[model samples]
Target chain A: MKRWLPSSLLSGMLFVLWLLLNQSLDPAHLLLGTVLAVVAPLLARTLMQPIGYPRLAKPIILIRLLGMALVEIVHSAITVSRLILFPKPDGMNSQFIKIPLDLRNPYGLALLSCLINSTPGTVWVEILPNRHELVLHVFDLHSEQWWVDTIKTRYEKPIIDIFHEEVHKENPP
Target chain B: MNEMETIPLWAAALLVSLLILGGSIILIGALGLMRLPDFYQRIHGPAITVTLGAGCVLIASMLYFTVLQSRLVLHELLITVFVLMTAPIVSMLIIRAAVYRDLRARKRDSGVESGGIYRFPEQE
Candidate 1:
């Protein structure tokens, strides 16, 4: 099973996406979707990094994180709308800040970046190469420490828990 | 169209409200791009459009079709998924390019000197 389905999660998503795109439950579509799902991942496997598959140690945490992110997105959308409609006389305080990251799992970092960027007021600019710090640009700067704490506690902590990178670090293969 | 009659009143109302909400949100996002003073802040404008705005319109489309056809029409989900997956990457690249350009010119807001991610040519 491992040999054929290198990433079962990805394969399943691809299969479902194929069927949905076709908008059909026909047997022919099912057969074609299955074949494409199996083949596409295999072909793309060479491009993937050697990092071990991300194990969802706690799936519930991931779901909760997504839910929280959705709420944040809506909340920030309103905040941003207000900011745009009613401009500050002195101009908005937009600035770049760096947050140190403890979650070393590439997948976790990717998800964090996506989540941050998806929110209206924040963007992930870059990661410091020498240091495992994320450079983020904030549209409005209220307090530097607050943003750092929020990113660390609210976002990074849950991702770290879900990925369980500490276990990987402890027992390296 | 005859198909328009197939949708229930509640569904049609919901669809219209969602579309209006989404369009207003997108309009605000576009206004941000023009109103924001700097590039970094400007990029954030479209983030709203990509996330909640697009999401609203897509959900409305899905509901409209599902109600019209009397079936589960979810291909719009593919658009949502693809947009969510790719929007960040595009913004990330654009921001990086802008940073590199600003850093080369020794601009104040590049944050390269403070960020310590990439060394400025003067430092090198």
Candidate 2:
């Protein structure tokens, strides 16, 4: 079963999307979607071999992250709105800061970038892989320490917990 | 307090809030793009519009349609989920490309920070 359907979830989603898109249960749509679902992943498999299954223990933590991010977006919008309306020629401290990262997991790193970039006033600029540092541009550079702390406490820790590194992750409760 | 009161006030209220929230979020995101100091900072700004802004509007649509039809009308949920997943990938790729360009430019401009991750060692 696993051999035939490399990604069962992908196949299922593809089938569903095909149905929804066509808004019909016609024989032709089913055949085409099924063929696409099977063939596309198979083609993709040649280019990219699938990785080992990921450790997704704490689902609640991910939900919490989403909630936190939404709130941050709202807060950031208001702050940016104020900054724009009242031009802060002197008050605003715009600069780039390099954040050192310990989590080496590619997926974790990707999540970290999304978290940082989605929030207003900050952008992921450069990632120095050799040094394990991410260069981020911030609209208001209140303190370098603040940015470092925020990234570590808010994003890195949760990602590490969620991704579950064999050697790095602590035993979850 | 109008004579035409077929639809519930709660539904009307939800739709109003949804549009308001969605529109404002988009506005702020665009404003962020203009207000931000540099190109890198501007990249993060539109994500607000992509995620939360679109999310609120979609939810509103889902709610309105479902209530009107008296059934669980979804499908917008798929778009919301799709956007949520895709936005990060797009942002990372763009940022990576931009950083590469910046690093290359720096190497051309100043003959320093060479052999770092930002730069490859020149062949002799």
Candidate 3:
């Protein structure tokens, strides 16, 4: 299975995306999509690093994480818009917060970075190589500890479950 | 096109409202870029527009197209997905460069005679 489908999730996503993009269930389209989905991953497999196995404990957990992340994204957009619209430079402390990452998987780290960046106010700045530490810049930095706790608990934990071994997770989400 | 008038009143209302909300959110974000004092703070504005505002606009488009054509017209979602994937990368690179430039400038300004360095300054 691993030999044939080096990246099952990627292949599946590519297949679905192909279908979605073409928007046709015709046999020809299906055949083409299947071929592309199979061949593309195979061709691109060498380029991708061999991560042991992308962990997805449960679909429900991932759905819940995405749902929570979506809500936070919306809420932060509103909060950031308000902060931007109402100028209060003195009160707003835009600063970078460094976090020591327990989640080390490449896929997991990418997802976490996307979540952090997409949510209006927070941007993942730099990650120290060799050391599992990340620097994130927050638009409204009221408390450093709060940002640390939120990123670790709310985002990183779920990601670790989604991509790392269950036993390895610091705080199981 | 006559297709505009043919769209149901409720669908039109929903479409218009979503587009308006998305546009206004983007506008607010642009305003943030203008109003923000520092470079770090200014980046937040575009972040709002890309994630939430683009999402809203894309959702509205999906609604409009699907209702008008009467099929699962969700290919437009590709834009949202693409934007979601790309926004962070662009920002990350820009910020990395900014930080790099800022650090070198700081080192230069302080008149520190440092050896050849080829690494990102650790954010502490």
Candidate 4:
């Protein structure tokens, strides 16, 4: 099973995506999709680095995090639109702010970055080298502390919980 | 044209609203690009279009095709997934490039000096 489906989830998604793109359930398409799904992941596996696979310990938490991110995306989209439409006389306090991150797992960090960048008014600029801090650009800055607190508690905590093993392995406690 | 008449009233209403909403959001995002002062702020404008605007348009497409063809046409979801997956990476790369360029030139708003990420020549 492992040999046939190196990553079952990936294969499943690929197959579904193939079917959707073709917009067909014909046997020929089904066969082709199945073959493509199996082959694609195998090809990808070779190109990928030997980073440890992200084990999602708490699927529910991951889902909740994604849900929260969607809401945030919508909320910020509106806020950004408002700011754009009605610019303040003095101009918006757009600035770059750094947030210290506790979630060290690469997958968690990747997800967090994706969530932050997807939401309007926040851009993931870069992760500062030699420190576990993320440099982000905020479209409108009101309170730096609020951004830091929100990112640490709301986003990072859940991600840490979801990717618990990696953190535990690194910390050894 | 004949197929257009087949779409139910409720579906038509919903589709029209979604398209209008999506169009307006995208328009605002474009306007934001023109109005914003700096590179960082300008980058955000497209983020809204990529997330909410594209999402609305894709959903509207899904609804229209589903109602017209009388089948579950969800291929638009693939576009959504691809867009969501790729947009951040693109923005991240662009922002990184902008930061690198700004820092090299020692621009005031680059945040390199004040951000403490990189030390300037004078600071060194």
Looking at model 1, residue A72 earns an lDDT score of: 95
Candidate 2, residues A1-173, lDDT tens digits: the string is 75667666567778888777776679999999999888776666655443432345676898898789888877876676667557677656666677788887766777777777667677776565456577776776779998899988988898888777533543334
Runs of candidate 1 with Cα error greater than 4 angstroms are A165-173, B107-124
Q: Which stretches of candidate 4 lie over 4 Å from their true place?
A: A166-173, B107-124
Encode model 4's per-residue lDDT on B1-124: one tens digit a residue: 9889999999999999999989999999999989787667789898889999999999999999999999899999999999999999999999899778767676555454345754232232
| DockQ each | 0.56, 0.26, 0.50, 0.60
Which ten residues in a row are the worst by lDDT in model 4 chain A?
A: A46-55
lDDT (C-alpha, whole model) for all candidates: 0.86, 0.71, 0.79, 0.85
Ranking by DockQ: 4, 1, 3, 2
> Which residue segments of model 2 deviate by more than 4 Å?
A1-50, A53-55, A165-173, B1-6, B35-38, B95-124
**True-structure lDDT of candidate 1:** 0.86
How well is each residue in A84-162 modelled by candidate 1, as lDDT tens digits?
9898898888877788888877788999999998888998988877667888888889999999999999999999898
TM-score of 1: 0.91
> Which ten-residue region of model 1 chain B has the weakest summed lDDT?
B115-124
Instruction: Tell me what TM-score chain A of model 4 achieves.
Output: 0.89
Error of 4 at A127 (Å): 0.6
Among all windows of ten consecutive residues in candidate 2 chain A, which has the lowest summed lDDT?
A46-55
What shift in Å separates residue A156 of candidate 3 from its native position after superposition? 1.2
